[model samples]
Target: MNVHFKYEKNIQIEHLETLYNDVQWYAYTQDLAVLQTAITQSLDVLTAWDGEELVGLVRVVGDGLTILYIQDILILNAYQNQGIATQLMQQILEKYHHIRQKVLLTEEAADVRHFYEKNGFTSCDQGSLVAFAQVR
Candidate 1:
């Protein structure tokens, strides 16, 4: 199977809508406008494709210097467990490693924690505590 990676300028909003809607851990139902705004504001985004189909994607949101946040790493259900997500992340790290900026986040699952660790992210007990308001 051949995998191609592309840094996209204008992702088909429908593709993102489909991926986000199908992802249980992500909350994309609030409003389409909000989702559109968030996607528009992302600093950089990488998408992986198997021919014409989008198989995986990851986005980086930050100031482009000093700090970066990795978000929305997703691989379609049909394509999971085939190292597609890992490859997507590897490409992100390769592009950003030289900056040596601190990347920070809280993952939703232990399996995801392990995956992040494998990608050189360390668990930090000293990281800030985050609280969120209840979403309706």
Candidate 2:
């Protein structure tokens, strides 16, 4: 498993579809065009590739100065528990260390909470902060 990371946004639709679907994130796979546009327009994108196969991704959206929102971070099911996601998180954090307001929203799950907590993130309720989202 010689996985390497890249900060490239010009990814192919097939690769995006395969990786998103592999992680069971069907919503993004539903619209390949929109997904591609989203990636290209992101503040930053870090992708893990095994040879030519994209196995992991972490993307951010923000002005790159004051706030950063982790729009998505995922790894293929077969590639989980290998620290790829953590590395992705680390790289992004290091890149935006100066940003004061880093945020992300994910489904409520034990593992999800643990992962974010392990990555030095605290839940909204844990602090004096509350988050709201409008999903469709």
Candidate 3:
């Protein structure tokens, strides 16, 4: 798998919907306009592609100096468990290594928890940190 990475803002909307929907993250896939705008407006957007296929992406939003929120990190189902997600995240973390707070919220699946934990992210309960979110 020859994957190319880029920190650019010109990915096609159709590609995003394909990747997002592949993992069942319909909240964003349901609205391409919102998703495209969100991604284009992020502080940083890292994408992974195999030739012409959009296989993975990492989107972040925050002040470059203090806080960084990982809004999304996704890899197509066929690409999961292949270290693509880890590489995407490592790129983002390296770019913002000096930031004090790096955060993200994900579902409570065991694999999700395990993935984040392995990447050095602590759960709110584990780190004594409180996280709050509302589903609209």
**Number of the top-ranking candidate, with TM-score as the measure:** 2
Give the top-scoring candidate (lDDT): 2
Off by over 4 Å in 3: none
Span of ten consecutive residues with least summed lDDT in model 1: 126-135
Model 3: how far is 20 from its true place, Å? Answer: 1.0
lDDT of 2 by residue, 59-114 (tens): 99999999999999999888999999999999999999999999999999999999
Q: What is candidate 1's CA lDDT for residue 82?
A: 90
Candidates sorted by TM-score, best first: 2, 3, 1
Descending-lDDT candidate ranking: 2, 3, 1
TM-score of each predicted structure versus truth: 0.81, 0.98, 0.95
Q: How far off is model 2, as Cα RMSD?
A: 0.6
For model 3, give the 10-residue run with minimal summed lDDT: 120-129
> Model 2: clashing residue pairs?
none
Output the worst ten-in-a-row residue range by lDDT, candidate 2: 22-31
Off by over 4 Å in 2: none
Candidate 1 local lDDT, residue 72 = 71
